[model samples]
Target: MEHEDAVGRRVYGTDHDDPSPGPRPGRIYRELLGGPLDGQLFDVTDWMPEDLFTGALLLAPLGMYGPGGRADYGPHEDDPFGPWIWGGDTP
Candidate 1:
């Protein structure tokens, strides 16, 4: 059997190409609903597609309350992956 190399686990699915279809910001600034709601998050959460939200939720780190951690992989370094993982600054 042939095995495939997996790098960066999936957030929503194995298909990494299916990026979110809309704006990825968690909050939106709106000016309409008077003072309190003005310049505040408009609660557009209900407007977002379920798949996109769920997929992002999966990608988020459960412990950190988010997955905003930064990961930089260098070509010449080896450890988490390997030097030969790629030939440039990124894989």
Candidate 2:
């Protein structure tokens, strides 16, 4: 993918001539939302299912919440994190 940023910065660009390698499956797990946990937190492991290796794969992280957690209907009022809803759409 090749594109310019908002400030006209030539960002990531991949050369088409370069030979690409085949897709490889791997596993990654994170404890907290942003950091490591001392004990067993939400452990998630991901791998390309056996049938999905023939093409490129886009992996997105999924999470599970415990009791008393607010359902993330939309962005928070205080904006603790970055913009939740992207694009021009509003909540």
Candidate 3:
């Protein structure tokens, strides 16, 4: 089953992608499916068309680490609707 936040934005969990609820009507969201951010939703509805986001996504480090470190996630097989897989952390 899928869930929605207080204002009705979809919130996908780590082990719940049933495709039954499907995506929200006009929302552009991606799923993170591994590493530190497994099962998290990434909302990209406001991104510009030419941002060139096909490369690795750098997120804040999850565990104890120094500053300027990040976790990486790469696009999974070029799926337009994505579930980006984790690539590890750089510290």
TM-score of 3: 0.54
- Taking every candidate in turn, the Cα RMSD to the unseen true structure, in Å, is 19.5, 16.4, 7.7
- Who is ahead in lDDT, 1 or 3? 3
Task: Please write out the lDDT profile of model 3 over residues 22-86, one tens digit for every residue.
Answer: 35556666666777666666655666644425634554556234346666765666763456677
Residue 7 Cα positional deviation in candidate 1, in Å, after optimal superposition: 12
- The model with the greatest lDDT is 3
lDDT, residue 26, candidate 2:
41
lDDT of all predictions, in order shown? 0.23, 0.22, 0.54
Best by TM-score: 3
Tens-place lDDT per residue, model 2, 18-74, is: 353112134222211221111111112343434222211111122133332222222
Q: Candidate 2: where are CA atoms >4 Å away?
A: 1-27, 33-39, 47-68, 71-91
TM-score of 2: 0.16
When sorted by lDDT, best at the front, the candidate numbers are 3, 1, 2
Per-structure clash totals for the candidates: 0, 0, 0
Off by over 4 Å in 3: 1-25, 48-56, 63-68, 78-80
lDDT string for model 1 (41-68, tens) is 1123344443222211112222233354
